[model samples]
Target: MSVINKMLQDLEQRQPAQVTASNNSKVPAAASRRSPMYIGMVLLLLLVLLVGFWFSKNQQLQAEPANATNPDAAVRAEPRQPAPKQSEQHSTDQAAPAAIIAALDTTNTAANALSESTTASAVAAPAENAAVNLAAIITAEPAKPTEPTAPAPLVVVAAEEAALSAVARPQASVDKQPLSVAARQHNMQLRANASEAAGDTSAAIVIWQQIVALQPAEAEGYLNLARLWLKQQQIVTASQVLLQARQNGVVNAEINMQLAQLAVRQGQWQQALEFLSDQFELAAEPEYFGFKATVLQQLEQHAAALGWYQRLQQLQPEQGRWSLGAAVASEQLGQPLQAHQYYLHAWQYRQALSVSSHNFIQQRLKATEP
Candidate 1:
């Protein structure tokens, strides 16, 4: 029995060994079945990873051109990896593609923003250059000259007349050609005379000065200017105007007569005689003979005075002044008979004489009776 128990123990040990082998073989078959599932899971994980990598590559390819222009875009385009958890590997695998897609979207957005900024800068650069060029062109051009404004009318005209007078004074002697007075000057002269008639001496003086400035070589303007000046008691200014007239080659009989009259007023007999000398053509004028006769009588040259008076009487037969002048000079030269004949001739026109002269002539006629 002991021997049988030993064999049985041996069989039990054999049985345990067979069971161990079966369990080991079954474990292998089950492992084989689970292996395909793990393989499939691994293949799916690999596919997901490949797709994520492809999307990352695609996003990189798209971002390359933008990164070339903007270096900051390259930094923004790099993919970021999250820290993986051992328990959440499947969950991590599923989220990887989504993250990759999100990164691609971010990279695309950055590239688009970079491209838009570059375009804006390009457009703004040209606009700024155009503005700068316009400013430079405006700066390089020459400035236009402004036209001179006209001066005021009346005051400036008066100043111009004064300047013309000053300039014309030195040239008066050399310019002998008589300047023709314009019709405008003549019209101005008429206005001046009208002002004088209206008792506006100041206005008349201003107009006459303008007329003289217009026609410096004309004797009439100088004469009128002198007359107005003398009327204002400006004797020196009147004399200066007459001298200026002579300097302008105005040696006419009227100018000489006015100068002689002025000299006579100043009690300058020699100067007056020299002004009315024979150098001037004074023969045809009856007044010239009369003035010379009076000047000769003042010098006590009774014979010369008598000759001039007789010549004046022949020229004006019925005038009482000529007859009376001849009578005075003849009586001074001691010819009583000729004097009596002249006194009777003057008595016929006694109404022309003043009251004192008529009384003197009546007494002389009674005294020198024939």
Candidate 2:
């Protein structure tokens, strides 16, 4: 039939839907009275008719091979404008959008034909040929000279290490390592001693830690291991090492003192004070009193902290204004008179320093201020 006749038939078919909507009571009465509304409806009917005619024309149009015209440019049908929401999203997510849609629409029916192939014979020919042709074409095209992937080097596991893993490992027992393990450990200790003689504390530390790992029962290993960890500023690890040393019946007060020092550094006042209680004074070190005062203050033994500070002042009058710390601590401990006296003593020490020391004193004085 003629194009105009086909368009009119399609338009007549769609007119029933518009007629149904117009007859619905929910549509305003004023809609029926408006000429523009009828005109708009007619225009919509015309547009649909035009689309139907264009579709019919396209169906009748001659088909050709894709590569016939411009070999690189695939021949495709003109695309219709997308519906509003689809158009908005498509515009945002695409550039050169019309061409993409055109290409897609043109490929649609060929893809549809492949999906519509129902017969077993039809399926076998296309599916097998398509896959095989793709692979063959790829293989026949060219070989690219890609960089060779290097073979991984084989790892050679030593016999002793292999045998160790082959046996079921038991839980590490505390107190004593096996004698053979101790011999191996003694080798490392001697190695570290030699490395230290060679002036390599870093290498000595690594060797010592390895020895501790292999034979944790040796008290000397634990002690030296703790010392190495302490030098590394790993306070908690050092404390744990010394605790394990105690399990080995380590009787040295110095080891406990080191553990206490690490504990106090981490503000564990109870642990620090407990360790210190068992300690004997080998010499009257000023730092021992200072550390004792620190532990007392942290443990809320403020009066004790102040007394230690006062003892420090009496023993060393030449020392910087430690009386400031005493004043603050005593005041916080509710000794107002003692606080006033210590603050005055702090002031007396302040006048004795030079310009550089004067600034230092000013800072300490500010700290002592009420």
Candidate 3:
């Protein structure tokens, strides 16, 4: 009975010890499970940090190569701080794991602050690098040179004018050549005509003299000069000019007719007949025939005057003056019957005669009746 009671007491004390031991064993098991979960979280955090660091480093490396390739970009880039020494980098890497561990061991709020700080640093570092690269690229480009200004409008116009003047100088000089003989004579003739029209007889005479001097063979110049001299009642000058024209071998009919008229005006009837005799080719002309008939009558050459007046009467049958002239010439030559016939013919055209001529013809018809 004593042995059985002692065993029961020991079992009771052992049972209490066993319960405390089991409780101790359960605490170790819970602690072990929680440790593995904490280790996985720590490992995940470390992986994230390593990935962030690697991405930032990759961006930095890319930027460095680009900057090296372009000297201008490198020059424009913000001056970079010197790279850390190998030992310093190594020490920093070693300290990073310790800092992460410390953050994990701290309160949750402290760990969260550490994570936010790390994230902000990672984001800011890339942004700063990108800003630096953009600045370098923008500043490295070359500045464009300014364009040259154009010449002023006034200056360009002046240069053009100068060029045109240079081209035209020779042409203007060419146009200044002397006029030809015919052209000069024609211009002088026009000036003479203008002076004559303006009643400037002396100026017209001077111009005509210049024309005659220029071309002495031109009959028109001598004729115009003689006409102007006669207008001023310069009979001797006109006769001299006409005689000079004849001496110069001018065969003008007007010259002979003008000399005949001048001799008749001076009462030199025989001289008028002699002067008219040179133009025998003008026998067909009524003015020449009539003037020759009148000169023969004045010189008392009745037979010659009768022939000319009868020929003139035939040529101009409607003229009463020609019939009267024929009658006078026939009466002078003692042909009374022919004179009476011409007087009757003259009376037939009485309306063509002047009042004085009609009275004379009436008296001649009565006196010369057949």
Tens-place lDDT digits, model 1, residues 1-370: 3423443354445545645765877755653354344334334444544444454445445455545555554444332212242235446545544432333223335545544654564466456545534543343222323565665667789999999999999799668775556768878988998999999998998998898788887888888888988999988889888888888877666777778788889998767777766554334777776787787888788898899889778777687778889999999999988998898888787777788878878998998987
Listed per candidate, the RMSD to the true structure in angstroms reads 22.9, 31.2, 20.0
| Model 2 residue 132 CA deviation in Å | 99
What's the lDDT for all of these models?
Answer: 0.68, 0.59, 0.74
Better of 1 and 3 by TM-score: 3
Q: For residues 98-190, what per-residue lDDT tens digits would candidate 3 score against the true structure?
A: 565566455557756866776676677567657745654465444223465566777899999999999999889988989999999999999
The sequence of per-residue lDDT tens digits that candidate 2 reaches over residues 15-87 is 5664687687566676445534433533443454344445433432321222233333222222222247345
The local distance difference test score of model 3 is: 0.74
Error of 2 at 111 (Å): 99
TM-score of each: 0.48, 0.36, 0.56
Off by over 4 Å in 2: 1-202, 206-224, 231-236, 248-254, 265-267, 344-370
